[model samples]
Target: ASRRDAAPTGDFHLPGWLDVPSMAVSRSTSRLRGPGPANVSTSGWTSTMHSLRVGILLGCLAFLCGTAGAGTPLLLAGSTVLYQRVLTQPGAAARATPGTAGGRLITALSRLYVYEREDLAGQAWLRVGTDAAGRNLLGWVPARDTLAWNQQLTLALTNPAGRERLILFRDWDALRSVLDAASPPAAGRALVQGIAAGGTDRRAVALEPETYVNLYERFYLLPILEIKDYSTAAGNPVRAVKVASVTLPEARGRTAPGSALADQGSAAEQLQSFKAAIVFVVDSSLSMGPYIDETRVAITHFYERIRTAGLLDKVAFGLVAFRAESANEATNEQLEYVAQVFAAPTQVLNGEDFLTRIAGLREAPVATDYFDEDPYAGVLAALEQPDWKDRFDARHIVLITDAGALDGTVNAPAGTVPVNNRAVPAVDSSTGLNAAAVQREAQRAGVALAVMHLQTPAARQAGNLARATAQYKDLARNAMTQQEAYFPIADGTRDRLRAALDTYAGDVIAQIERSTRGAATPFGPAARAPAEAPADAADDADQRARIQAIVASLGHAMQLAYLGERRQTAAPEVFEAWISDTDLADPGLRTVEVRVLMTRDQLSDLRDLVAQVIDTAQTDLDGANSTAAFYDRLASIAATFERDPEATGRRRAPELAQRDLLLDYLAGLPYKSDVLDLKKSDWTSWGLQRQADFVDRLRKKVLLYSRYYADTFGWVDIAQTDNPRNREAVYPIPLKDLP
Candidate 1:
């Protein structure tokens, strides 16, 4: 039943599992009374009722057994489902049912009949069996939390990384068809993920306490790159897990991904989507022969591997080949640099079209008198090309050059070698953008820029080579959101260089995933399909997207703030995942794709999440990762605020006052909001500024109240600041007395 074709697709319908006879007792296993209820005289009426009940019970059991497999054992779930248990022994420290950090579970048992039992703490305990490594094993489980003679069926899928993906279902026929069609991974197992019925909207699989003995809440994932998204609607949720473990041809390009929520479409469309603009920008000097050929081959290999994995729908390719202009060409200015577009960026994933386009690149028709080519010109041309898509899901630019940008400040590389005065500028050149402008444009356009220096053997010994590497490396960092974005792939060999390119092919997917993942839902990239917003919902959807984008932006900012305060120098994604999936340690975070914009209730929840993150950062600062410094900074700020003389005398900040008013409203104290005073026509009229003004007005109420009772008349103590803390005393202060 692990196959999708084997999964149930229709509405869940049980075949009379609970239908049982209710006959009067003819006999009893214990006590003096017979099988019927005690004190029943065997009268004609009683006999007739018994016959009907017996017949009904028999028919019910027969229906149930028909649906169930023959001789199948079953166990009753204990009172406490998702109860903690150790795989080792009864007294061992408990672990999650799925168990943290292990290979895929081969099989899950539906139920175990208790041949024997022990009573412990008013709960029935029974034994369950599991087979592993060719041996039968028995584990202890609490009995009777859930009771059903029928088995709870599940589909357990695993990725090549041994990460288990399981989905529980009452019935799903679609899943079975998907599984049957999928070709498994080269190494580990592969399984499909599906929507089921559960606490969450989708992720419908229900976890059985007896199966895991580890948890009641269930979570599952499907291999992202391997599976096809079954649904194509604008809002369908597609569950996915990172496929970083899957091997691909090496790549060296840098990747910068945009927000998952900002993507053009819903989760399913986004996952099925690929729109990227990658301009190779290769230096086409005579010395670049082997460099260009090998780079193209490496990329070809990468495409082949991804094609095998069914991920071509997620990528596009472009090319730019350049050469230094001859002395006769200097009249054309930038044209003297001789940079030209080899292939405009387009979706290569649709077919084998990219291979032919890339094969067309060759050495320039003429050679240059100078060592440096107009590398900057080549890069600028790539960014200016019109072939790139406007509404890209992700975008990247790969810069490949062998020589240094022309630097006017430094005398022509040891002279007499005929200085390439058409030097790349530190910033934008008079004719074109320098590294800074290129990077700034990339960042603004959400295009990641990667600089791959195809170095010659002499690159290390020359001062010019060092300068070029330094300049390009800084360019890479500027184009990316991460500090260690450059890959020093020691491109001294063909294999090493190919490996670097392969890194980009894989890392691009990874970086995109990190940037787009939501903070409070299933921890995968969240995106909307590229379809136009419906006319009826255009404004509502747009505003919703804006609010979510803001929340996600703040989430990113909070993580950065924590790292900055702590003086840490690590990739930001580390903390992002921590905040998004906080409960992964206890029970796994619910695996549901949350792509919709937050509603009013969800907005409140997002606020709560913000508060939790802030509070957690303040408390858990003593670890070795320099979180202690972050905590200390927070404490220092708090102390400073507390020590403020103005604060002591109730001269509170407007923001603080506003927060107090909002908190009160959230706590269910809905006084006629002063915010509604300047009533707007509708929510569309209430932009962010209006929302801010509302909070400020509400805050003014708090401040005015504070000044009257505490500062002006001394009606209440300063310590009793927030409203309702001392309601009776506050009321006695009088509306007339209030300032």
Candidate 2:
């Protein structure tokens, strides 16, 4: 019978080359009597023997056919018996012959167990199977919630002879291609291909069927997938791709300093220690409503920006508003108002909230008719808090108002400009020059004073107010200016303010960087080294000798005579007397009141003498002669004061003297014209040299006089003899610090 006949009714057929037919037999039995040996001849007997052999062959063929009917059961039993023998017996004793089909099949099955271990974070397991060609197959598995971008999957194929081959799929596309290539045809031997495909969620799809295989029994490392929000220039929605190992929160943390995991903890601690005490000097007067609205918007934006930058972790802000008097009030009322401090981190002020508050401010009844809109008084009040000095490192008193200063005192006036109107009084009786004194006090306490002037018309009309406002704006905008100087506000001041703030912050960060990572060691005691010279030793001997020679020449050659040719005099007795007499018996002779004693005529005489001395010194110094123009100028100045003590008060004698000394020193230098005529760029090349020479000459003269003063007064001369230091000291002292 054909193999087709042996095949089961539902079984599918193999190709022609693989078909094997089952044997079958037909049976019939009949008894025949055999003749006695006497009846057979020798030839007949031989023929009968041949016939008997043929008959036995025919019988054997019948038995084989019969057995073919029960072939399936016999084959199953034989296979079971062989399997038992191979498993139970020792490997050496039961070894199959080389090149045998059974031996090759056993070797191929054993080789399927050999596989390399994978050490990926999200790996599941390894699967093994066989293709239609009987080739071994392998694949990788993935864990739940895992998304790997551009992942490479590999397979190891081991043959019956124990030979191994590696097959790699570069990505999902490659993996799909490999599976398609290995797929079996419908009408052929079905080879087992082991692969299982599933995922934790709908968003993820495993490219390979073996992605769910769990290599680790109870542990798995989950892969992180990133979902990005992409937008167009107009902020419209755009497409997003799920990227592997790109976490959104982690990215955000990396971009912003305080948002990082490590920084967040520290930032929280810092926030706890941060306490802000802000005094907002808002302008609530009638003229400031519109400006106040805009300011509110700006301030709201500022708050929002701070919050977005994560600065709220270390900041707390407050407010204070001020306004003018009501029309019915007899006296100008300047309201002193404040907001209760909010201690927690809050969202930026909303526009509606700001507008509502501003509107309420406009409608609110006046608290005091005598207050008026005096920003100076409000400034003083804000800065005078008892605990203010200790509470904040960044104390800002922002004054947002129109006009400069006004009197809150009552006065009789209908249409008349009140005595206090637009007048920033230099002195206050009640507060004792309190406004000016407060400015000084704020500066001393290192409290920043920022004045945002909303006096639009006045600020625009007058250059004085504009200049003052500009300075104030600078101070308000720049924290560094607050530390070093004061800046006032004016029109077009926002950019300057922002730039100053940036510069100040940059400076602070730079200082931090330097202190943390500079050549100077931090948190250590002062490093001590042996001095180059003893403390009392004469340093720079040659320079000192030269200075001494110049001083001696100056002392000997110096003369003080009126330009009108009065007898040549020693550096005037009155000047010497003035220097020697410390006690100011005459009120006019006191340093603060010296200007009161001078006459106009004496000033004119002193001016002429100063001019002559400069000319003479120039002539002598130009020839490299032992001359001292610096001393001569100093003497000329002293003589002016001696001759007419009040000359500087009557006019600007000190200014004139400074201008002459600058001009004289310039003229005395070899490159005087070059120094004076230098453009801004030329300063890069010429400034250092000119400064060096000026400093040297000025230092010699200052030292000479300083030494003289020390000797005469019996005081120690601690002044530095360097060029820069001497030039700085040569300028006449300001009136406030003169005595």
Candidate 3:
């Protein structure tokens, strides 16, 4: 028998056993012809050999089956043991076992599963499953603080057959370490940690928690890893995974049960409903030619802008012109009979008319000439009218002029003082018509006066005329020469006028608006519009322009004051005396009290003046700023009179009083070599003296003029003295006590 042909074929077979067969019978044997008895014997021997091989193979198969059957349980037991060992002591596990012949028997396993989700304490939890090889796995552990008490989450586990089953867990942290290892710290609830098969074989894996458990009052992000598996165990490549983030909104607190006081309107709405008014008192003095023209133009521009911007509809405007005298007197005479009245009685001129008026004034004779300067008279006339209060919602007088008040009597000799028939002996003794009276009247009327001086050659020339041209130049120079000469008295007149205008305009407007709170309202937009569009539009435009010009002029005048350049042309003492005497008694002449609301620039000027005074005092012990000294003089006049009546009543009663205080303060200061060395101590005494003198003069003036000037001035006496001596001096005449 051929060794290749004789092989046993039963339940078991061996690799080198081809000669063993009961399975070697071939259909081709008949064709090969049987050998005779010897051949038959050989064949029989082959058969015998085949049978023997089969028998041996059968015995071997039985033994192998028995061995395998016995070892199967052992293998299963070993596997269980290994699993237990790995489970209990994970580090000692191995990847493969020893073979029956002597080497290791290796097996690969892979696993993949969707982690189970659980809700614990308002947070989501997930438990990940193992891969096919049961090697590496992951789980999700939710933050306990983030979860509510009762919550649930779902997870899916997948097998090699592509089948998935849902799993649920109660605690988020109970998942296996393999699953937990896969989760990041930020991941919620359940986490996954991987498992290793053998100690040597490490399988890297990630387990994704499928669902969140009880997620109340919390936000969640999308799941990160949809699928997870081990690279080496499943023969599959591992892929990167991302975890989803969660966010939640802040909670709101309950409001108090009884709170009901809430604002009904927005801040803007409240502000929008507020009402305001502005009035302009324009100077019609001849000197205000180009300026007045410019003012008108500016006003026109202002009106146009305001109308366009829609502010005109809410604001009201009024106009008053000062320094217009009666037409008859020869020197410092009134230009017209109705001198003090405002240009527009009920309303400001429409644009065209205002411009035309300005042009006419510009073309007309120069009214600010030496013979016609009487700003004081103009101010008084304006305040006297009965309809003044009702003409505009606000009242403001802006005086634009070049010189101070002139003698109202035009034909009087230049040197003679005009007699004041209206003066009361107790109040005023030395003067013709009292110029201070006009100031009192203005104060009574609650008028705020602003002065705008327009510089011109004629105006400046007039100043020289008052000093050199008059026959009583020396007398006038001596009597009136003081800070009064230096101060632009004309400018002061205009300032008084402006003050009146401001007070009247501001107060009146406030009153009107207040009074009209529920009065009949103006017509609505639909009703107010009328036919004649061009004419009406032109008229409205013109009115608005005029108002605008007035506003601008006022602003400019304020700017000039701020610059300390409010005085235009300095007038001579003679001119001021002449004007003061003549115009003081004129019905149009009146005193105006102005409370200046200082601008930044004006404040700066004041500071400079103060600094200059300090410097000057240090350099030359005599106070150089006469204007400041004058105020001091005025303040001390009362004290000097009270202490030394006989001395105060001397030739230069007011003047001597002023000079004495100034000298005393200056003499007390310690001399300094450097101009910069004028410290606060150097000026302290003088400053206090100056302040005292000013207050004293102001009080006396207010008291003396208050009665006669009641129509124009409002009086309220205020004393600012702390020393018992000073207080005693101030007490004799209280401001409010005056009639």
- Which candidate number would show the highest TM-score if scored against the true structure? 1
lDDT of each: 0.32, 0.26, 0.26
Return the top candidate by lDDT. Answer: 1
Per-residue lDDT of model 3, residues 277-312, tens digit only: 333444565446555555555555544544554544
Give the winner by lDDT: 1 or 3.
1
TM-score of candidate 3 to 2 decimals: 0.28
TM-score of each: 0.33, 0.26, 0.28
Q: What is the C-alpha RMSD of each candidate to the true structure, in Å?
A: 29.9, 49.5, 49.7
- lDDT digits (tens) for residues 1-739 of candidate 1: 0112222244332321111111111111211100110010000000101111000011212211111122222211221111111111111121123122332221221222322334456554433332111122233343332121221111111110111223332123333332333331211012222121212322122221100110000111111111222331223233322210100111100111242322343323333333333467788776777778877876666567656655555455667776654445443343333566656655454326777766667665455655566675566556655545343444556777767664232324454321231221122122233444345444333345666665556555555566776667656743112221333334345555565566555555443344334222122122222222223222334434432332232222222222221221111110000011101111122222211111122222223322333445324322222232222222222221211111111122223332332222112111111222222244224433323222222222222222222211112111111232211111111111110
Off by over 4 Å in 1: 1-274, 330-337, 347-351, 414-430, 479-484, 489-491, 509-739
Worst ten in a row by lDDT for model 2? 37-46
lDDT of 3: 0.26
Candidate 2 residue spans exceeding 4 A from truth: 1-278, 324-359, 363-372, 385-388, 407-435, 458-739
